[model samples]
Target: MHATEALRRLLEHCPELDRTHDLVRQFASMLDARDAAPLPDWLDHLAVSRLPALDGLAKAIREDQHAVVQGITTPFNSGVNEGRITDLKLQKRIMAGRAGVPLLRHRVILMAGLRRSYP
Candidate 1:
């Protein structure tokens, strides 16, 4: 009936798949928790699980261990700055043929709500 039920039916006869599913859930919960404390144990499990697909991921996690921890521990990110830059680029592209630098500057200023109203 549902996707979850279908998946359960599919994995019902496969012990290996059930084990894989458990490992996947554990990793997912660890990621959601954003605490690297379980990472070491997770990595060990990954190695022991003998899943070739996760080998590259394990290596990547090991290589970027510090950055990953910082990402999980800190609430800081460049998302806002990146979004602003993306908006500017899109605006520039949309106004490319219809206008020049001066109009583009005015549009950007207006879009940013920086244009002053006439008194």
Candidate 2:
């Protein structure tokens, strides 16, 4: 089926989904514009949306609302640090009980070098 036809049929059957789609689009617009001004209103709408999953999400985000707003407004992120940590964890798991610290250190250094060279 075509995408629009399928979507139209879905909205016909589950009207609440239209609200969900609108809320999602609003949030995406906020992100694209790097604006958190409308976030509180968005949270309020989500909290009363009567959708259990989205309500839970709204609660969780409210708990860390400051961090979420900061993430939206700032260009700085932990992506590089997170990638490095993931690389280290994967290497540790791969070499578990099979190698010593020296080998692990060598592998980590090589991985960092490769990442820098490629990226």
Candidate 3:
């Protein structure tokens, strides 16, 4: 049988997997909808579900619940900040040991914020 068919049969027999699947879907929907209000209920269920595999995930979300909520609700993200950090790190490594602070700074200033020519 196909993998999906096997999983379907297994899920029919495994109530735990069924519950986990439903909970995961609800969590995914909450993320897509940026709805934080339902997070506590979901976490509560996850905690009592006793799924040892997901303990770390639960812990992280609990520790950063506020940030998680903000992340879900806010349109702002760290993409730009991460990109700039990457660019700066790359430029610094390239210029390392060859230049002093001023030249390194100049090179970083010149290289960053510009698109690479791929010709």
Indicate which candidate wins on lDDT.
Answer: 2
Residues 14-50, candidate 1: write the lDDT tens digits: 8778878888888778768877788888877877777
Looking at model 3, residue 119 earns an lDDT score of: 14
The ten-residue window of minimal lDDT in model 3 covers 110-119
Q: Judge candidate 1 at residue 28 and give its lDDT.
A: 74
Candidate 1 whole-model C-alpha lDDT, 0 to 1: 0.77
Off by over 4 Å in 2: 79-119
lDDT of candidate 3 at residue 30, scale 0 to 100? 89
Arranged by TM-score, best first: 2, 1, 3
Put down candidate 3 lDDT per residue, 4-116, tens digits, no spaces.
89989998999889888888998888879988899988888887887876566777799989998998788888976787678777877776766777987777676653544
Candidate 3 residue spans exceeding 4 A from truth: 1-7, 78-119
Lowest summed lDDT across 10 adjacent residues in model 1 is found at 110-119
- Which rank order by lDDT, best down to worst? 2, 3, 1
lDDT of 2 by residue, 1-119 (tens): 99999998898889689889889999999989999999999999999999988899999999999999998888888989999899889999998868788998899999999999998
Give the whole-model CA lDDT for all candidates, comma-separated.
0.77, 0.92, 0.80
